[model samples]
Target: MTSLAAPAATYAEAKDVARRLVEARLAARPLAGIPGPLPDTLDQAYQIQDAAIALWPDEIAGWKVGRVPAAPGEEASSERLAGPIFRRQVRQATPGETPFPVLVGGFAAVEAEFVIRLGADAPAGKVDWSLDEAAALVAAWHIGVETAGSPMAEINAIGGVAVAGDFGNNAGVILGPEVPGWRERPLDSMACEVTIDGRRIGTGTAASIPGGPLESLVFLLGHCAGRGLPLRAGALVATGAATGVHDIVSGQSSVVSFGALGAIACRAEPARPFALGTLAP
Candidate 1:
């Protein structure tokens, strides 16, 4: 696979590039390229994220995976979309009633995911961590909905490398308040019901994630370790989307909850189209 962990930049420097990619998308303008919007290659992205962590001293909030669903009647386990979380967006957990923003000209969708917070580090590239070792690292288990936006549609149109350079296909996230003992719950058989104003729209099982939520974390730990990265202690993991994306409308209410785990019900407010933010110095 292509990676940014190349020879030119040190791990720290490479991470900065990845963080810059995050800023660019949140600050996109003017032209839209096919393969990518960044001036660098996908291989360079590995370095970008590497540097982002080093120079920024940002919190490794959590991990998020994507495309967890492959076929109908199948599970979310076999799919392969994943990424890390920045600290700022992890804790603003919403339960009861919360308001979420939507870009008038942005791509966003809601998905159901299992949120797992770690008590120990799941360093990247470990051949394997025992279940007890893995379980010991976890703190709380919760069901949450991530209202994520991405630059994928346009970036992927050109090249995956291009998409790779674009923000790890993310915008922001919302956790639906923490659930009690979410990890101990039968996440695999956990039933998820996604509703729009009380109408059921989608259904999913926790086991859909290849190895369930924890397995997804294992994959990420392995993936990052191979690149010389650490999963970090207290990192929250948003295992892939158990239920794929659902279209939303402004001013409409969207609520998603899993059986006895946790639930997120929020009102979608569309932001008026306006001039983009001022250019950074």
Candidate 2:
């Protein structure tokens, strides 16, 4: 088992790093090295993540789950990581609504995702949740796009620990229409395709997400419980990308189709400028 205890010195350093990136926004550059010391384990990484969340001063609108490729000889069951998505950055769009704004130079990318909106609170302290129990918490599901961005440009290259340290590289989310009676749908077998500017960019299914969406929720439930993060009612949880991540630029249009389940389309625009006081918890 991994140790959950992280040094106090390291925690403070991680918090400062997150504060600088949050304040810098699109202007923040990738660090050549994390100050104090780099986190060497998932527990340490999440410690940095929790500290960073405290510094952001915004209500968490949702969370984005991403699979961390398992290390050689590591079990597949232990390969998921999560990050927060602030409420100010979450947006909802219909098939032909206005485009979503995302940071242009700030590690912008798009991912086709399966998103669940929780109906009941999954309070902290309970860590053992079955896939069915996790699924029962979902109020609805949607075909959506996660606007992936990070203040640090080299976050992806730095690995999952770094990714977790900076809100899991999430910038924004575009929610499409809810899939009514989603409980009856066969999510794992559903096909999804992403197209940008009318050209196909990627294709995949829920099967690509480790253990599928419900199981991913189970992992997240346990993770947040362990970290003392509350999973409140109405919070949106986006399962990992189905179609692979695709680079996107400001002013580009994207369309994600989840076969007969539904489709969502939106264009991306340059992020608006904001002062530090704009974000609040």
Candidate 3:
């Protein structure tokens, strides 16, 4: 966890940092540090994220949820954190390998994900939801891969506050086929494995996610509602990593398999700029 010794970042300061991060992301360049004062809390960090979202030339396609690991013996401020997944970065995996971009000299990793797509809009005024209520909003569950990257290589080392500030350390996602009869299946039964460069790197199941995937959706429903960013129908949610975050570099190949359901193969490419004014529809 990031120590709260520093004063919370003011809006102007947070925006400046957000601008720098957004610019670095668009240009596929690396930054030496957070461009402004480090946000002392997750709320302050999200303020920075909102500013970056406004500056980004893309629409929100989905949101990715990640665990906020608590230090030993200390309670975590929150169990999970969320970040926007831009439209341009969302890809549908096809036969053979789908390529994802990674910023060299920065943070880059891949996580096997259990994704949920919303079937209907969540009530904007609803701030609390039960597990069943959250599950009801899901259109489908799919096997996917979350591409986690940041211009700051030390983002994770800085803790959740920093990660929340920079798009939840998300770069993109590659969605695979929907898992049929997912509702009746225990998440832990949907075992997953991540292999990078022909070597198995990580393995686990949705059971590893605290409380399970629907609980993650429950958290997001409230988290977004509180921020006035109510989730829309068709939005996707990448529940926390099923296996674990495994590091990779440019040119490496990886495959994330969701047993019996399907698998998505991806190759990493050196990240390229988003071309100054380009925006995805």
Candidate 4:
């Protein structure tokens, strides 16, 4: 039988793979595949993620985390995956921010999530922080929408490893008001619903997110440190979607309700090309 061995890994190889995806994202073009084989492991996938972030000139606005679903009959993993959110793409909508721009001809989805804004840095180089320690770093939490998109339409077809390779399939974040007494609330018990153009699409809770938000933050803090991407103070970390991911298209409006927390509404418009420097402050 012929040998079936994978090629050795290198940062250069990883960066090259990331470069193609980055270019496609910037130009709003779809990508077929990485130049070579896709990253096979989570570590390799994160390497590509870091490389891709380096290629982008925009400032890091925040990070988004998502659960990696376990296989059938297997216990769920405590670990979570992350992606960077560029500053230019972060939006603050009070009660009526309408017509958000979602890229047409791309992998686009919306997720209703609880977002945490960090008050203290969970400095890099430490790997054993507890959930309470991580929660202490949070300054505030908000109900928000995570605009998930990618240049690779087939990204999810390959699994979480591939999604992690491309900025966790994150494109932007739509921030809402801060949640009062968020710490006192039972996040896992809170329910969230997602709708598009007045039609209900999905409903879920923090329990749907592996380990809940605080645990997800703990996982992110350690994961980022291990991957050399530190969790900085003032960064917004949108925890995994409370409501399941729902498909969206340009020209449609989306509304996400988090029960007593409140609702966020935004319409999607076709993406228009613009200079990153102009958008970045």
Q: Best candidate per TM-score, number?
A: 3
Task: Give one digit per residue, the lDDT tens place, for model 1 in 3-122.
Answer: 222344444554444544444444542123322223344456545545444433346677676643323454434535455567755646554666766554445567787777777776
Span of ten consecutive residues with least summed lDDT in model 1: 29-38
Please give the distance, in angstroms, between residue 238's alpha carbon in candidate 2 and its true position after superposition.
Answer: 0.1
What is the alpha-carbon RMSD of candidate 4 to the true structure?
4.2
Off by over 4 Å in 3: 1-6, 69-78, 277-281
Model 2 agreement with the true structure over 1-281: per-residue lDDT tens digits:
22223354366676665666666563433333344455777677777778777777578988999877344476544478899989987888664844776665566778999898999999679899998889888898887889887755556665677677778878878887787777776766677999999999899997788678888788889988887876889989899889887887888888888888778887888777565453332
What's the TM for model 3? 0.94
lDDT of 3 by residue, 69-175 (tens): 45466665447999999998999998999999999988999999999999999999799999989988899998999999999887876778889999999999999
lDDT of candidate 2 at residue 45, scale 0 to 100 = 71
Flag clash pairs in model 4: 99-267
Candidate 1: list runs displaced more than 4 Å. Answer: 1-24, 28-59, 68-79, 123-127, 130-132, 151-164, 177-184, 270-281
As a whole number from 0 to 100, the lDDT of residue 71 in candidate 3 is 49
**Candidate 3, clashing residue pairs?**
none
C-alpha lDDT of all candidate models, in order:
0.59, 0.76, 0.90, 0.79
Query: Model 4, 13-37: lDDT tens per residue?
Result: 8877787777767767666644445
Ranked candidates, highest lDDT first? 3, 4, 2, 1
Give each model a TM-score.
Answer: 0.71, 0.86, 0.94, 0.89
Evaluated at residue 245, the lDDT of candidate 4 is: 71
For model 2, give the 10-residue run with minimal summed lDDT: 1-10
Better of 3 and 4 by TM-score: 3
